[model samples]
Target: MAERQDLTCDVAVIGAGTAGISAERAARKAGARTLLIDPWFRGTLCANTGCMPSKLLIAAAHAAHAVRHAPVFGVNPGSLAIDGQAVMARVREERDRFVAFTKETFDDLPEGTAVTGRARFEGPGQLVLEDGRRIASRAIVIATGSEAMIPPPFRDLGPRVLTTETLFEIPDLPERLAVIGGGPIGLEMAQAMGRLGVRVTLFDNSTTLAKARCAAVHDALKEAVSRDLTLRLGCETSAEAVDGGIRIDWTGDDPGRAVFSHVLVATGRPPNLKGLDLDRSGLALDDHGTPVFDRQTMQCGDSAVFIAGDADADVPLLHEASTEGAIAGRNAAAFPDVAPSERNTAFTLTFTDPPVASVGASPEDGTICGRSDYGNQGRARTEARAEGVMSVYADADGRLTGADLCCPGAEHLSHLLAWAIESGATAPQILSMPFYHPTLEEGMKAALREICGKTSQPVPESRDFGNLPGG
Candidate 1:
């Protein structure tokens, strides 16, 4: 028996996470009859669990590290202690306040709109909820984001074997921890926990952190790792439960095992595409179970049906996901004959200590033209904040391709690089500008000097400035 209920809307958005919410709001503001759906009554990960909470904890860890190291600068601080529980409590409270504010924005949608439930496609223009209700729309968007992937051996993520999803729930600080995977999540958590007095062992199948980043980033991050972390690179793990904690078993030349108080699997994430009954709508899923969609416009199968966020098969981040969702929302309601805006301009920041942030091509994808140090070596030494590297990539003709940073002012530096990459700022364009001396951004100038074939005046190596030397 074909059960059918009539529903209609100008736009239907699924998964009200960052991307979904942005798209929903934009669609509604454009005078479209919009309906948005999500399972989290309180809200999605960015609202409750992902970016917001994780960054708060990372920031707290940074503060704790700075205070503990104050004595080295002749500022003696007696008895520095990290109350992990208190810090986590503050994170939760802040998260609650943010979620409440988000709810207000979502709740104020104009009347004659709104639906809250698990929405799945029933047909080309129809959706069925778990509660047996149905709605039809001119367009449907699947913005459902991603979920953490746990391989079979790690299925039992008990207290000690944790994923990012459960990492923040620990009641006490771990004495020693092993973080598996060296991507953004792993590197960020490894650096954060290591700063908070946890002996962090970072295990990665690959030798480099964020292989997508430029090669120079590995050398810069290796310097930071030299300070607070144990880098167990180029090792694949065979995990097993043990007495005090779990032991990560691995084999390479000089193979060994290490036991830690806890193990965090920051491996990677997969699309949360299950249970949507995608086949019910005659939609095809790729082998990995992500929705197949037009990469440029994010439109899946029929032009009227679209998907965004982690489920879109390429590019996943709270920042990217939301932007993609907004585009999908606009494109879904757009006339089929009209072209969408140029495919999304995106940015990503890895919130590690002396955080590594980048935009555009991975080092492997482009040519590295210039490099400079922020903290220990060059101008940053004079500025008393030597902490990171600024490296840029360009095409053979000197057009901007990508850039990476690991330093004190990386957040601000990333903003400028983002603009450069997005605005098609040629290498010469950036090189032409004279930066203020003794500032962190001088690293950018040094890098530009290298690209422009100008010899960089080397800063003396004798001056430590307390910033560690290169890897």
Candidate 2:
């Protein structure tokens, strides 16, 4: 019999997902002897399943849509057929390449760092592996990513009912697909399938889609629905099955029956905190079942231990997960005392046809300055990509509280918004930043200008400002 090994490190990060990997890198950069652990693979959902593969599939669907519809642009490209199985293969190929790329990155990390099998805490600052080995660390980071929130009645997924994770593996595109939940995941999948010539109907339990983003984001998404996707608004799903293909029952206040061939549920996500005994580690859970910790420090219950990413609960997006992971890692290495990083910012992107991106608060979160929409512009039409809008909300002082965008380059544009919010830059300051013309991001600049009541000069940064709008 092999002898059990006991390991020790300055920091131990659990789950090798986006947040986990980021935390590992941040910890090593901070000179902490870090031990990163997960289930063999170094990359989590973003690397293996969630972000990468899904986006690739969407990209393929977009290409197919573009090719078939090129005649509208007078290009005369005709007769397009989608080999969905081949698309899935290509997606898988890309996924494998990305996973390998990440493995290479992980291999380049400094020594004394280790990644092991599934680990469970025996006590505070102590973990036991599946092989009965033990590892000790001064600090811990829980970056375990989230899993699909399977809707009721369809909890047992099969031929007809599918979750986000399983939907990616689908070989055949359904003739009609019904996606429950109007959030980013649901909208993206709905758009992808709809573009691939599937009659896609999306249901938003509430009034809006992508509720976390701005109303303008939904406005843009509505344009996509106008194009192809069918939306069943103000509806809630009761159950689903796959008899002939798929059938879902949804009920609204009005008299109507909604059914489809396939059901994809993307309502929301619950943290992957089940099975793991958090109470044994002295962690407190919030109402959302996420780890309740100091937002600044990522400390759970005590400073000696910490957590990050979806495992922590409320903050679920990739950007939030990475930022929280970095903080947790830094705090773990610099135990007892550490300078707080004011660089806490998040950028969220919904991977749709014209992907929606957002930073800061939503209009629903008690806005100071209300929202405004940048309607369909010539740039989007020219690129054949104009299907969304952009909006932002800020306070009287022009501190950005929220931004929502549904447009091309929304993901990239949202980062700028996040930067402005983090730096306390007002809407005027954002407008002051020079943006190249004929770009989708100009919409964000335009939005800022509309709120600030000024158009920036060609060389705006050179001006000697008397008082900036927010200041």
Candidate 3:
């Protein structure tokens, strides 16, 4: 609590999350003195609450599901017991390990390089902490990350309502859970809870699940998830604290209500710009109170201020956050001469059974699409995972554009497709690449070959960009 402390550095980064750490490293690598400031010491959202913890929960759910469905493969694994306490213990134990690793990064920083306090903009290149400390820097990077949002109806529901952040800390899984939202977090957690023996009812105002853009993949995923939980898609609902738990009331696509032991609000997580006093920073903020920044360069307007990670994006994924953090940090160190960084093709995956994955651009009107059903796929049949579908899209000129998949091994398929898209591989060129027989990847090849057959466009002898396969 040094009331008269004043510090100066070439770059000042707020929030020691993934983006902030990356920014600090990049700034230092660029030979600029940098200071990282954060009040919380837990870790990045991915390690603590967002990605790793949730995936751990999903892993437990997958195990339970496999036991229940073992009869289909003629292997009776016997009755399954989901020890809720043990599951959560392992989740926290492992989660803390991830958090500890992140904490090490900050702890290893040189003396005076990290500060623990909240800060506000005093003016351009100047910041004042609530502790009466001042910081003057050549440039600044905002990487404050995001937090889960709860609507008015659920905000007052007391401990009965939880967010992805709080859900992991609970002692045990609820006997009955009401999950509100059909987005990735909502759907993934809902199915996991259901598979773990919780009576889960998922409600979303939109009928579309997981933002499935391709209709075939949408239907396939919807069908698969329906078996795992109560899906009340296209339902408008509100909650009230009641006896035993909370009650949900709705009258949209569905006209019914129910009460649950607990409610999870997964509607959204806007950037955590609260209390930063952004108005004093001389930045233009949209109606959402987010700073208008150049997403390509991670620069705010043409100023020395840069914004990265969840705080700067409407769609914040971990990989993109990491990418932006590096870009913003480098530019912040080399201010007034910012340049846009190269970005990879878009890729997303919902970690569910028969997980949904999308890569590159989504299909547009008149885009030629080739599809296949896993119900007839050779490897799928052998694995008894015949409950999904996939599609790969191309333009009339016949270059690979993108893909939508809701099938077994989708995580792998989407990655290969993303690389193909990045490599600028065409349908025929991808087909020409050897696909081992009777594997799930053959399903991808099936869709791609179908695209080649459906069009009379001459096959490209080479679309490898520079990496000619088997050359």
Candidate 4:
């Protein structure tokens, strides 16, 4: 072995992904010397594989869907042809640009701030790089990120099996696809492929689509996406290598067997802790094998170590990961005397046709709320995409608690609710806000009106307010 070299920093952040980047910036902003280490320096999973590329493909798929359904608008475009190869190429081109931007951002970090090598724990506050370099730090943040999890049984299926990591790299779209795990990633990819003319069969062990907390949203999502693809929910599934492809077998109320050219597994993500050797760090692991970290401070137990992003398992969305990273980084830099950061309201979205969005606190038993079906909403009907529902929930005190939306413009609606809930807005206040006529936002207003009626708070009467200054 070569002689070991030693370096010291105020903070050391593992992984150069989004979380790692945010952590580094936060630590540096706190006047601490920060070092970021990773073997590969692609920006993040979102820019490279998860969010950006998937949306590009979804955009192309939506274009194809729109042309095919143009008759509703009294416009007939004839013989719409979809070139899968061209679409994939365009997605790659745009994805590469995003990846390049991430790389550039990393490169622009302050000089001597980053190292390119795999790092493992040598001891508490110590890291050993692959080539015999050692780093001593006052604090450590594990933002090592995660990898797409393929169940053990399907690991040996070779190239026919794909994950978010590999799915975007395919040169051409497959004739048929078997998507396992009907979560956001699975559903998004399944619908995109189906809309792009690929035969897609989606399998989920869970009975509900997207595991929606609201039954109305769950039913609406099932109704909307099931129109484009075959969904086999609430099933136990198995797969085997076939002659030219793969065979998927499932047992349930909708049990069946099918062969597909490719199988995309969006089951879950496991933290990339294989080589970090957390056992040497003296931090306790949770039931999921992740380091025990406070959600508020992002600190691992009471140690000088921190965990963030997908590594925590509890916070998986990109924005949440970034938030955790910022918190962990700041706390790591100020350990033993740090002010804890308050977590934002829970917000998540699935990018489908009508989209699926959930925000703020989850609905619980005895929770009274309001519901609106977009099928009856004017905007959705006018757009010929009237197939979803929206629900807004408020506590007995009339404060907005949460919302679930499986409707057109659900993304925007979720943001609105997240802001309101975080700001402690009441249902009556939300109802009093202006809702323009014949817009998707009117659907939100309709739900708010129902919630307003359920609350003990009196709806504002026009006469209750004073006249304008001019009057």
- Writing each residue's lDDT as its tens digit, candidate 2 over 226-245 gives 57687777876666454576
Query: lDDT of each prediction vs. the true structure?
Result: 0.73, 0.72, 0.87, 0.86
Off by over 4 Å in 1: 1-6, 344-346, 365-368, 375-379, 382-387, 454-471
- Which ranges of candidate 2 are over 4 A from the true structure? 109-112, 240-242, 253-261, 287-289, 364-376, 384-388, 394-401, 426-437, 441-446, 454-471
lDDT of 1: 0.73
Flag regions of model 4 displaced more than 4 Å: 1-4, 463-471
Worst 10 residues of 4 by lDDT: 462-471
Considering TM-score, which of the candidate structures 1 and 4 is the better prediction for this target? 4
Model 4: per-residue Cα lDDT at residue 184 = 92
Q: Per-residue lDDT tens digits of candidate 4, residues 351-469?
A: 98889988876777466688887876777777888778888888887888889989988988889889999999987787676656667776766566567678767666642221221
Where model 3 places Cα greater than 4 Å from the true spot, the runs are 1-3, 457-471
For model 2, which pairs clash?
220-388, 246-261, 361-401, 361-402
Model 3 — which ten-residue stretch has the worst lDDT? 462-471
Q: Per-residue error at 297 for model 2, in Å?
A: 0.8
Q: Sort by TM-score, best first.
A: 4, 3, 1, 2
